[model samples]
Target: MIFLLGLALLRGRVGDREAWHCGAVLIHPRYVLTAGHCVRDPNIPNLSLLGVRLGELNLTTNPDCQLGLCSSVVDVGVEQILVHPEYNRACLACHDLALVRLSRAIENLLPQIYPICLPLDPEGELGGSTDALHNSRDWGWIAGWGSVSGDPFNAQLPTVLQKAQVPLTPTPFCDALQQRYPDPSSTLCAGGEGPFTCKGDSGGPLMIDNRMRTRWYVLGITSKGPRVCGAPNTQTLFTNVHHHLSWILSNLRP
Candidate 1:
């Protein structure tokens, strides 16, 4: 489920066509892992990315996608947008992460479209202290279309493609949420009290399921929470993708 696409120039109106403001992860076939404020928001002055929508699960009609009854969909057109060069729009989780790059190349692969495995650590260790994600299993999974009733002005978004199962908020409660949101030591705090992850589930993915569960290790990306999304102990913040995996394998281009 990928879908970034853009054209949110705002105020100066670039024709406003944002097919899915954020959420991505297709690690290659033309790369697409998102969230650097979904490719630079800086409080939104110009915005404007445009590209990414592989095997979508229904963003309200597409190739007749009655919510994952989907048969075909693959938008791809962004030819580049690599945010994290120490991204810091005043630290919502600095170095939020981004890497889109697709103008072509997604030759029909499915199981709801593929690509999502980038957490390796056989000693060439990088961030998040990987050892296949250390004491693994703090629980995961977090798909998105975002809001399901965390109403930031009536955001009832859902047409299928919204998963959740968070749990992983203990590093002294993410060090007390990095003392009120400083998060960037590679972030990584999950949520509680039933599902969480709102405002368009930022950069999507936070998977993890491999203990013979047959692979699925994405481990973080959705970055930021507590604007009342499932707010009961609140914890969201992601973006650890194994601590940038060497800045996402040196900006993946192949």
Candidate 2:
């Protein structure tokens, strides 16, 4: 997982920087995947891309950050921001994926700072023909340093990385909630009940366990949810990484 340390320049102040905003996932040694909105917006001015923080679990303090206790965290510089060509700020659900290229390739590839695998099959098959993600019983996890409360202005944001279990919403049910035509094939809906992802959780990965249950695969990217989060019967939508696999592969540096 990668935390986006967005440093937006203020309108008047030349060297002024704003706060860190969104989350992301490491998809390659130098490529990080996140929402297109996190990278650019036509309305917002003077906002510049800073970089990303890797192997980070806590944001507030490093109380027990040692060899065995915590993973070593490092902040890398951004070389480029690649938002999908079709990404539109007007449409929140369409083409929300983006990729960030680090200025330099990461040297330390530890368990905590490794890249997550993208889905190979359009149907979301994991190495085999079996569709592991088709069943609603197969649960996935979403992690981020987002605000615990629905209110964006809430000062009590979580310092430690938080995770929530979100079961895949059946396609029939998800399809019914489609607001636009041609219903985006590059999106997946989940979290009908229990804990749902909120603001600041955007661009985080929706991870599913592998067949052997040994490792997790990034199935989706956190996109949008109800205005009031965690509401019963409301499902959160994620940018389907499976559908965008080719786009991701094409953007990565060989």
Model 2 TM-score relative to the real fold: 0.83
Top lDDT hit:
2
Name the lDDT value of residue 35 in candidate 2. 81
Candidate 1, superposed: residue stretches over 4 Å from native: 1-22, 25-33, 36-51, 58-64, 67-71, 75-78, 87-93, 99-160, 163-175, 180-191, 197-202, 205-221, 224-234, 238-254
**lDDT for residue 30 in candidate 2, whole number 0-100:** 81
Model 1 agreement with the true structure over 43-159: per-residue lDDT tens digits: 776777766666666556665344444445677677778888877755555768888778887745554466767777523322245433435456667777777897678888786
**RMSD score of candidate 1 (Å):** 17.5
Model 1 weakest 10-residue run by lDDT? 4-13
